[model samples]
Target: MSKHEILIVDDEPANLQKLKRTFLTDYTVHEAKTGDEALLILKERPVVAIVTDQRMPGMSGVNLLRQAREVRPDSIRIILTGFTEVEYLMDAINQGQVHRYITKPWEPVALKEALRQEIERWQLRKENERLSEELRLANEQLEKENFRLRQEIESLEPAGKQLVYESQEMRELMRLIDRVVPTNSTVLIQGETGTGKELLARYVHDQSPRADQPFIPVNCGAIPSELIESAFFGHKKGSFTGAIENRKGHFELAHQGTLYLDEIGEAPLDLQVKLLRVLQDAEIMPVGAQVAKKVDVRIIASTNRVLSREVEAGRFRQDLFFRLNVFAVFVPPLRTRRDDIVALSRYFLDRCRRRLNKPIPSFDPQTLALLRGFDWPGNVRELENEVERMVILSEPDQPIPASMVSERVRLASSTGGSDAGGLKEKVAEFERSLILEALRRHGHNRSHAADALGISRQTIIAKLKQYQLDDETAEG
Candidate 1:
């Protein structure tokens, strides 16, 4: 994310420097010696606030600001004036959206505090506009769903919480989802934990033809082995002890809709066979039922583990893996999509601000910078949790401060912008860190690290050479 900006205009170079020093910590300061210079800057860059001296040589501050409204209508316009310029301040207020007017020879601390408040107000307004735009786009997409599937499913948790993407990686992922959703084939989503695989699956379902139907998400790892069959295929009344009433299993519940199998790699061998049968035949037999029932269900499965490795290790069924892998989508981790960090943060901040019913605006610029600096190992879920916590700790009518941010994030920023880099650099850093940790755990043995990573020893050797870590490897 780019830095928040403040434009300080004054004919006197000393005064401009003073004003710049006041906000150098919180904003990227732009200095101008004349109204024309400031106007030229406005054309090129957007600013959060414009502070101009009321008395200038040619064009007065009020006239310059009035003209600036056409360029940056959302910017907060302020004028530093003397008592003699009260009349000009009124004209500025009436003609432009002048936020405030401070008398000449103002206290630097007081002016700084006033500007911080206005900056927060500007940030909140911009974030709100962004969120409203997202909602508008979501409604438009719902309309394009052809108006047939717009009933109860409109309230599905994916509405306001849908995938928000700014990075090209996520944009390409969404495009792939669009291409595959029309096919209605079983989709296997792969990603690390907290990468929002389930949300992506629901998004895929919402784009499918069976959108209005129920979306049943079942965690294969959470169910006990004994009750697994009953949970998937259901049981008739009195099918077994404590089975007092008939139950509709997930497949039946999601008939004509989507059945999301989360953590699919954790499914037992028997369960995998049953899943493969259902996928092939589109039919299921209830426990203790005499006949099979046909059902229309689409499969969307997600797993954190590498399923191919799971199959090779005899922990997963090869046939089931093949069936689900017909269509695949990968949700990239947060650290790899650094550009989306600020956009997603603002999205969550808007949600939490409304839900809590507080006047707390957005995060201070430094706080946001610190947030971007930290590598979100837990991904989107962890970011949301951190935002919610910061919102709760914030005071009304103020932005969340850097002091309120998590200590780990603060520590990350202590290196002074060390996290500044592009996607390839970040991804390579993450991969290198993982390889180093794996080697450390295996006493720096490259062979064991390769095995644990599901790669050949030769490939690990190449990676170690590429990362210049060959010298760190364990010697036989």
Candidate 2:
């Protein structure tokens, strides 16, 4: 453990010096001649306590401490005042802005005792928070392990769902799929693009009894708006001008199997109504047909979009979303499951080598480091393409050089992904940092943060919830 840092701010030249000297023997003291300088220090580093004079040139002590609360929400704050007015100072204490206020001509021993007590309290509070977080994380990890073991995957090999992974996240996802694969319930798979949502959908179908049956995939967004209905349900020979003969629709083709609806959120409003009918009745009414034909197809929908928001926006039906979300699966982005990155890279390298008949032994260690260091915003697909490119550029019977990697990847590797995140959670930590920075830069306004991030107001609300952040932890 290291000594706690404390910040002292005062307009008087000798005052801040005296304050710094007093705490020099106890803590790491940071002296700021003005409130602005103190806030800059707070932003740059961590300080457990703030000691400031109540009077300043541009910003008063109460106001500065109030903003300091936003900068370092957990830091203890105390104010020194010599004036007769106590109304605003008391208000600051009441509002939790100032933890305590001391009068001028205070005894050094009394001030030191007060600061010690408050600092001890702050330390206790922080330790409690740290322990609570550790307990929460431990519980979550135990639950994950229990769930995976409960599925009995360790004793059995699932050849049907052969996803290449060595990550805990993937194992947990496989556990979820194992739980839902035995049933005929509809599944909705959601994730960022290139995160293998489609692959997960296939895993669900393969693990189920429907493995032997047809697996029909329909791109909801690729079909024309005028012919979407016709495409979904077979058209009669004379139904439309271009209808030459009858054809089996996806639902019919996938009878007794799985009908994958990729990008399901792109389905039009009218088509969504029809889809809901089919999901409810397991029947499809072909174009120019008076009777509905029964089909026994299991629906599996995949989307990169948020369907719940689409329902609220009236672009999607609530009933359809409810039906499709019976068994939900979220494919995490590749950057998250970095344990699989090296394995995937090697797998792709071998495949590419075999295809091209290249004698390249392997990727150089420096090259591998660059591959692992990138954020990979485009996810697995981007990585696969990059591996293929490197294979082409490598010399025969030699390890691939670091220079063979793309310039973009090289830049990302060199900067270590721009302090984006720590080792375990790059995406989340980076997102948290950006959100906090945006909040601070915009006067701790949530709306301003949302705008700065180019996301909707509701979206920012959801992000705040996802990160377990308090929306009201802002400066007034």
Best by TM-score: 1
What residue runs in model 1 are displaced by over 4 Å at the alpha carbon?
1-160, 416-476
Q: The CA-based lDDT of model 2 is what? A: 0.81
What local lDDT score does residue 389 receive in model 1, on the 0 to 100 scale? 92
In order, the Cα lDDT scores of the candidates are: 0.82, 0.81
Model 2 ranges with Cα > 4 A deviation: 1-162, 417-476
Candidate 1 lDDT over residue span 284-389, tens digit each: 9999899999998999999999999999999998888999999888889998897788778888887888878877766654566667767899999999999989
* Candidate 1: residue 335 Cα off by (Å): 0.2
